[model samples]
Target: MKTYTDTGKKDTRSGFGAGLTALGQTNPDVVALCADLTGSLKMDEFKANHPERFFQVGIAEANMMGLAAGMTIGGKIPFTGTFANFSTGRVYDQIRQSIAYSHKNVKICASHAGLTLGEDGATHQILEDIGLMKMLPGMTVINTCDFNQTKAATMAIAQHHGPVYLRFGRPKVPNFTPEDQNFEIGKAVQLQEGSDVTIVATGHLVWEALEAAKALNEESISAEVINIHTIKPLDTDAIVKSVKKTGCIVTAEEHNFLGGLGESVARELALHHPTPQEFVATNDTFGESGTPAQLMDKYGLNAAAIAAKAKKVMGRK
Candidate 1:
């Protein structure tokens, strides 16, 4: 087992800001569009540094998405920033029609995702954004776990011309992955290797998987941690190999248990190698006002929850 920790705590959105600022200087066509939550989305730095390239659309997310799509027509790669719900669900039609359907080069950067958004409650926490965004045709979905990967992904997605949904979170979390790590869309990062069970997770849940693996290690259970950052074009080869070795699986995510990371992994595993699988996520229920840790426990989205699911899956097999 491997231990990866952050130097200190850093929110993934801060990484987005750093990446976007770097993009502003490196890429001339890179422009940012933010709703009222510029500070929350970490777009204030981009707006402050390059005022000319930043567009504030008030509290209108739908219009911001449309403007981003239009900017693509003029050969501009516009990155629209907002909360997860506002970024995807609120402006889904606009994205589906103007961006995904038309294949526009727009970067949909969403922050404060999943149950981790905390205190703001269910209305703000978007556990189904992955399912919604990934369903759209030609839309690329990428969820970064920590600070380093988020920045790297932001930078990488900007270079790739397509309708991309880059999801991060508000609170500080693990910053484990290498700062200069290369991010490949549709690829999964193998954090730890094991033959007992394969644990596939994404977003902040990736850190939970790592923590769960540590607990499993204490119990003498060998567990593999596979970070499925890109939920859409999943790393099928890695998933198959891990499942083939373990013969059982446990999927973890901050999203709902249905139609998100778990379902995607289950569908893939069912087709390739039918195996017993358990899921650690929200039980299709709404989130409540609480701290990140409290919401995780209440929603069944913590390391202990993942570890329990892994044990059950392995025993079932």
Candidate 2:
């Protein structure tokens, strides 16, 4: 297994902010719009440096989406920043009608996503944003795992011409991925190679999946690990190739099992591979107020949970 060292802990949203700041210096066409949560989304640097290009929509998420779409028409690559719930669920109609439907070059940059949004509770934690955005025709959904990858994805989406939903979180987690790495859309990063079972994970659960792989290794279980950052344009070839080698699969994510990465992997396996699969995700239920660690433990979204699920699926194989 390839080893990954934790350089430091940083929130993925900071990565998005840094990426946007870099784009502000280089990309003249890249403009930003925020729904009155610039600090929470970590977009202060970009806004301060390029006030002319930054639009503060004042808590109007739907209006922000419409504004971003309109800016795209004027040949500007607009990035709209807000919480996950407001980014998709609250303003989905505007996105669908104005952005996705028209294939506008708008980047819906969502922060504070999933259970890790912490004490904000179910009302704020938007686990289904991935599903909501992915279902939109012509929408590119990306859920990055760490700071480096999030930054890379943010920059990469600016180059791609289409509507994109980029999801990140507020909690500071392990920044393990390389600082200088190429970000490829619809490409899976293979973390480790094994023969017993395959563990495919995305977003915050990806680091947990890697930790689980290490634990499984101690028990003599050869577990392959793959980091699936892009959920919508899923890297099916990498998933299928790994599953074909292992014959069983374990999918981990921070979202509900109903419409998240687990379901996408399940559908792919059912169609092409028919491998035994186990899902390490939130059951179909809303989250409650708590610290990020507490919520992760209670909802079975941690390393131990992933390892347990891996062992259970390996038994079926």
TM-score leader: 2
Instruction: Estimate every model's Cα lDDT from 0 to 1.
Output: 0.90, 0.93
Q: Write the per-residue lDDT of candidate 1 for residues 229-258, one digit (tens) a residue.
A: 898888889999988899999998888887
Best by lDDT: 2
- In model 2, how large is the Cα lDDT of residue 24? 94
How high is the lDDT of residue 197 in model 2? 90
- What value does the lDDT take at residue 23 in candidate 2? 95
Provide the clashing-pair count of each candidate structure: 0, 0
**C-alpha RMSD in Å of predicted model 2 compared with the true structure:** 0.7
TM-score for all predictions? 0.98, 0.99
How far out, in Å, is residue 141 in model 1? Answer: 0.7
